[model samples]
Target chain A: MMNCQGCRDDLVAYLDEELEQSMQAQVEDHLERCVSCRQEHDSLRQSYEFTETYLSSLEPSPYLWTRISAGLRGEPMPVRAPWSWLAARISNSAVAVRLAAVAILVLGVGSSWLFYHERKLTGQARQEMVQFVADWEGLDVSRVNPFLARHEHPVDELEANPFIDLHHHDIKNPFRHEER
Target chain B: MKRPKTEARAEDERIGELQEWLQRSKQQDLEAFHQLYQRYSKRILNYIYRMTGSVADAEDLTQETFVSAFQNLKKLKDDGKFESWLFTIARNNVYQQFRKKQIPVGSLDAGGEEERSEYERIAAPVRDPQEEALYSELQHVVNEVIEELPEKYREVFVLSAIQHYDYKRISEIVGRSLASVKTDIHRARLRVRDRVKRYLGQSS
Candidate 1:
């Protein structure tokens, strides 16, 4: 013998068929006796039916596929820039527009400062590298160039063996000579 | 609606064809993947639209969902779970968009007069003028109720009612326990019923 509150608590689950068979029977029993509980059940059922009927799924715009395909290909949509869209969304607010301008101005100035600082640092690094190379130019080349001596030897060997083809060629028919 | 046996059989056949398409898509078959997109794009679009209430946001989020899904399709281990996987991607994208915009939960600004007008314009037509007016009013009320629902309840409610996902599938899509999803859906349904009772009373 379930009370009205207990029955009401289980009504949603019973309607959803989520309740066990025994508990569902208890709800049904309560509904049979209690008009209030039964009305509540009907109201809940009607709400479900109403929403499911009226809140129908909509057909997306025809161009949605085009946009999706373009997106999948990493192409931007054939629409205005995002900032322009944002501007339109907040176009009614003069304050928002002014704030956006301020933010953009701040960003522009900050980036310019950063760029200038980066360039100055890069120029200093280049100057330091030039000075270091100039200082190192007086050092003996032999200590650093073990391959320099071997490089000349390879050139001399190549000159001596100018006609000696380094590439291997297989003669399929050594005895067969073309008629000149 | 209960489908007839023949219809169910046809549905099964379609599911088989879809599985084939899924496999070919995994092989980088563009045509096969396009077939998948054609089949599912509308459902995904509508689901996102209902969730966001703003058509523009829904369109962008739906595109992001499909793009993300395609990019990460190779990471998906099971072909059978593609629908839920795609839904998970959509849910994540919607949440990310919400976070990025910092839109408060249950804010009218999220879907205001513009969304209402768009919804009314696209609602199904009724034969009688008076009936059409009544239906439109009811639609407005219902849409308001949905848009006003808290974010947590909104997702589960939309998934269960509008998307027709089962409790288990909704749980999977939302990454919540079955008990929690069920509780949220129950509460959401009650909330919708209470809010729309006035319009429903008039119409009935």
Candidate 2:
């Protein structure tokens, strides 16, 4: 039974569902009969929907993440390196942490490389010695005996035979040799 | 007169998950912190944009808000109220910006935050571009109406009509009594609808 002007005053409250049940029923009944009031209610409702959707749907420009990350680093990002994107995002203190990580990584790889190379060289050396031993094992000492005899110094021969001791009578072991 | 409990229970579970993330973030788990950021960034960004009425200003304030939050996250005592706390920080960030600019914030008579260019920049990725355009234009008029409202009314209106916050929560945010918040929200709606009525008349 409320006039349009009375209904207009209650419109916002009714839309918010703040009115009493009897009042709400009255507004509803009025709205059903009143085309203009109903249209007004519907328009308000639609506008509210439009406001929510429009404002909430906006997104920042794509490069905003880059800018935020750069700001975090305490470094100015003039040019972005794709490879160092994560590196660029870390803070100043974290830069030192990253440097330490890189150092550790280099040390690990360098140490492994050195170990592998040394092992490879050792393997090669062992193979060469094995081949030399096999080649010499056949007739080496007897054939070298004649050659060794021709160039032998008595002092050298004495030194080569570790059992012979020419000095130091107090030495307890007979296998001890001259110092030279 | 018991209400259906599923939605409330679901909200509680969501808060619990956020609490877990927040706890991990406090422990210096960057990934957990990033998860928290991902969960909230868009909403926070949007809120700031609305408050400032400038996309650039909103972006700057959003970053500063997160930076401040990141630095002082340990100060937060309650995990369940994280959104309220975060939004309070966002509000403060906007407050500080206005303070720096010496913007007279108390002038409730000074009308309307800007609403068009910022909105125009957004490209809706939906299939019907026309619907998106129409929606955007409708929103432009609606937002202008919202912005034109007085500050107190605008705050409650945004929180209730736009953000869909409960009256209790809106009251808490505005630091107003529940009745005042309700009145302001009602008044805001009336003003906005009055302004947008012409557009609505044409469209309908």
Best by TM-score: 1
Candidate 1 chain B has its poorest 10 consecutive residues by lDDT at B106-115
TM-score of each: 0.68, 0.57
Model 2 TM-score, all chains together: 0.57
lDDT of 2 at B99: 89
Tens-digit lDDT track of model 2 for A75-158: 684332343334333323456578889989999999999888655654555454434433433433223222112212344576
CAPRI class assigned to model 2: incorrect
Tens-place lDDT digits, model 1, residues B48-100:
87766666677778778877777788898988789999999987887787778
lDDT of 2 by residue, B143-176 (tens): 6676667767776776677667777776666567
The positional error of residue A21 in candidate 2, measured at the CA in angstroms, is 8.5
Backbone collisions counted per model: 0, 0
For residue B64, model 1's alpha carbon misses the true position, in angstroms, by 0.5
Q: Which candidate is the best by DockQ?
A: 1
